[model samples]
Target: MTLASTLLWGVAHLAAERRRTGLALMVAHVLMLAGVLTVFTAFSVDLLSLAVQPRWLIVLTVALVVIALAWTGVIVWSFLLVRPPRSDTVGRLLTTTLTIALCALVLAPTAYGARLAYVSRDVVNSLFSTTSSTPVVAEDPWSGAERVNFLLVGADAAPGRPGVRTDSMTVASVDTETGATTLFGLPRNLEQVRFPAGPARDRFPGGFTGSVPDTPGLLNEVFQYAEDHPDMVPGVQKGKRGPALLKQTIGDILGLPVNYYAMVDMKGFAELVDAMGGVKVTIEDPIVYGRSREGLLPPGTRKLTGEQALWYGRSRTDSDDYVRMGRQKCLLNAVAKQADPMTVLNSFERLAAATKRAISTDLPQELLPAAVDLAQRVKDTRIRSLSFVPPLINTAYPDWSQIRRKVSEALSHRPSTRSATAGRPRSPERTPEAPVSLDATCR
Candidate 1:
């Protein structure tokens, strides 16, 4: 419905409800919900997002919540603070009417603020997100490489934590000519990588904070030691936090340059999946883990909710992060497969209502449609992924030594985004892109 129509309907419904029952519980709740929807729909970036994280749209929500709560509180406080005056019926009605009007007063500012915040965030993201690598595109880079590599990072928001831990790491390689995408998962717990010595340890027997000088087989201990001792000087700042630092750490690892970076503030992922009608992920093994948000998930292909999907990607219960990396890949595939552009467009009216409140991306508005189309074209396409976990990459016997080695390899290997793709071996048929006019069997 048009924003106007929806608002009119909500106002009419609220009026009728008030007439039937003054401040009745159900009546107030119904009105509140209607008002929320109307307001949210009125300010969404694109109505096509209902199939995604539509419900928690930030701007309108922040506005409406403040107004709604304030209204309720005021009405209750007024009743408690004073006796109903010998006021006429008209007076009471007028008071209630005025309160309702004030509640709705949040609409304009809420929407305006939400849009501003959304655009502002994108600006910040673009400014800070330096191209770690060239973008993977349909055409080959002049370097003559067919594959393009992109990095995925799982960042935590815990205060005092060193920037972001490379908890979940994955790399995707796309062959522009063949339309194939392969993903590699890197285990965060890989052995031998030296932990960045917080400021406290900079003067230690080792070297600088991030230097890997002789810190073999004791990688975990470094972080543990740094974490355990806040008294240490290098350890000041309560833990090195700052997202950009961790991005550097990852760039230090895989040897390939990174181009595009996406950081989902730890919440948007799960909500986004469910908002997209849930994803269909194939479970390699049974997941018995449970959380308040996501319950039990069996070992087969199943639809997942936001919390459930989050738990599935992030949970390290029975398995290590290496295994979880695999699960993360599955979830990514599922969401991409389930992206029903048609459903999204059809429900644009409602979905647009929901988009503003819940999610933001580094991609620009002009880029979104193209990204959507690009994602859609690759939909249902088969993808394969690899993870250089444990023995394949980290051969250190002790976890710490192994961690250091892994860290070194990660840093040494870390380079440009395209270099990583160049590092990978592709079938001879997987040459650079051939023009559409070229014969398919020209090879």
Candidate 2:
């Protein structure tokens, strides 16, 4: 409405000045306005669906660029047509210079904005291009569900490795309305994880006991296993062969339907962190880096670089997997709390490029807008975390029923005294060995 009123006023003013110049200016303004409106409408109307089609996006971008350039030319021509004739050479030269400067001042930002839009569109196209082979669902799988579950996998793929292993496995279950999120971290070494009754179950009757060379059939191996033995789950979609199997297997174990899966390459994860200007984390213990464990990350609250943060989350030479999981959760919480909308908008180009290179997901493109809204809501909500490790649950032979019960209990939102003590001050030296709830505001 504002843009419409402004366009109307501009046309009126131009028309009142001179008939010929006004007509020319009005035509140019109308074309530019129409082009701008069309682009905006495209963004608001099922943009995610359109974004997956690179060719259409490229065409639209080119058209907008052409219109912008032509609009500039018309504005300059109209200015010359309307300007008063100067008798002296110096006066005429000064008038022309000022007019050009004025035009540049007005058009510079518009051109810059158009360029950013083009870059953003290209980033979206690139993100989808790599994952084009991933299966597309007919409709949102969790359309009617009160809660949505996403399987987050951190793949560790070093050079020359034949296949990658999902070293980090977490299920983020979020309440659709409240945006209350519960992060359930499953131990990578967890064994005896059952699959739903079907061909998957038929193959692994005793819950994934098959061995792959030196590696055992642990929970983390599910993704790579599915990739290697695609024929095992013939009914599953061809594009989502690996993630679908892992989702099913993980879903059966947790007694919840996994709606989607997002796999992050470890290297790309570091780049993303760097792009976000590094995430602030409270390191409770010293973290060792590299296979030699020679490089040490001192403990304290500090902003860590991409390399430091990655090793801090994945390092297990000096610490155990449970501790690493805790650190990873802490890093994630810090990112969630600190990477506000403004921060992301400021660093959008870099972040988008890094994300495109690092992340792969089975999430449908149509649901991205809703997911963004949900993320905004999540920023205001406190995130509760639970890790299945050690005394909590046996990794060698996990009690599937017990784990499911825990997950259900956590999601049930049972009244507890823990919520009251969540924000209370605690001694710096008295950090809990295992924290059920994390303070989102903690530095």
Candidate 3:
């Protein structure tokens, strides 16, 4: 009877013939059940808003603790009432054991819920704890922006490397209403990148230049260049100066304001993929990448482990940077579409740990709910991609005006006049040559 009280709340009291107490407890149980149902229904409707709020998370934590304590107290009281007053020692032991088991069952879920809430709060605070010193393009939480542009960077700073390199740079421009997105890929070797009007412009009036035979003066070198010349980005923190310069340079190149940047360290990126249980991609040819270019990843459509996936997207052996860019885009699409809610939930802690170590951004904590909402919208719509490579635009002497015009046309939301894979041999894993839906591009 006392064990039955775990669900009935008053079973032990009723069995002990305490009619008034039993009836009162039963009424309280019914009220609590109804309240829980109502709260859950509301929670489902406003989940995005509520989940990201630290105060709301605290409230949820406290509520679970209180419920666990109160419910267990009632169980113990009911056990005491129903236990025989003159019972033998063996009977007392059995009854006590049963009560302990009942209490354990009640407390387990409550404990897990509280921990999950606490972890979520910690992650949000750690990821988005922006200070007044951090420079921002917008103060509001995305209230009136027609389109928001985010600079996505892949920083390669291997263990023995001297400095970080901006190996993979892409801009994701997302439509506020329709969730349509256009990805602009810039080659790492893009030279003669013009700096915007500022200290950098004054320093490099004739555009960024590098040594002829030694250095290519590639766009990727800009990050470390800013770091080396801290005076170029005065008043900014040492870690942030590189990204600040990149944002300005990329924004100028694309003819759009770069709102915020999210950079992932390539070394730690492998860990993130592993945490998500690897990424699935179609490999048309074998890829070779390692310390001495010894490791090889074979061809096929399969789920790749962290190291294999990294090589698949970035391998340069017997291939060019332009081909690698297409593979990287496909990898992005696969991760976006395959990482469902249940997979995330099951691997929540590992994923959170990997993300904290692998990624950094200037996004504010207050904008998390809005960002999450935007991500859901983006998932439902089509994503278009365009890369500035040879024939489209020269990397050594890029036509800035033509690049800007292409960006404008892509964002105009007009129908694409050219076929996505036009004028190019169709490979099994090739990304569309022109701006088009990723669905048609990715396998």
- Which structure among the candidates has the greatest TM-score? 3
lDDT of 2 at 109: 63
Instruction: List candidate 3 stretches off by more than 4 Å.
Output: 84-91, 132-140, 210-214, 414-440
TM-score of every prediction relative to native: 0.45, 0.76, 0.87
User: What is the alpha-carbon lDDT for the whole of candidate 2?
Assistant: 0.71
Give lDDT tens digits, candidate 3, residues 84-117. Answer: 5665778888998999998999899899888888
Candidate 2 versus the native: TM-score?
0.76
Q: Which residues of candidate 1, in runs, are more than 4 Å off?
A: 1-147, 157-164, 175-180, 194-248, 291-295, 299-301, 346-382, 395-443
* lDDT of residue 37 for candidate 2: 82
Instruction: Report every candidate's CA lDDT.
Output: 0.46, 0.71, 0.81
Instruction: Report the Cα lDDT for residue 267, model 1.
Output: 58
Where does candidate 2 stray beyond 4 Å? 1-78, 81-87, 125-141, 159-161, 235-239, 340-347, 414-442
lDDT leaderboard ranking = 3, 2, 1
Q: Please name the candidate that would achieve the greatest lDDT relative to the true structure.
A: 3
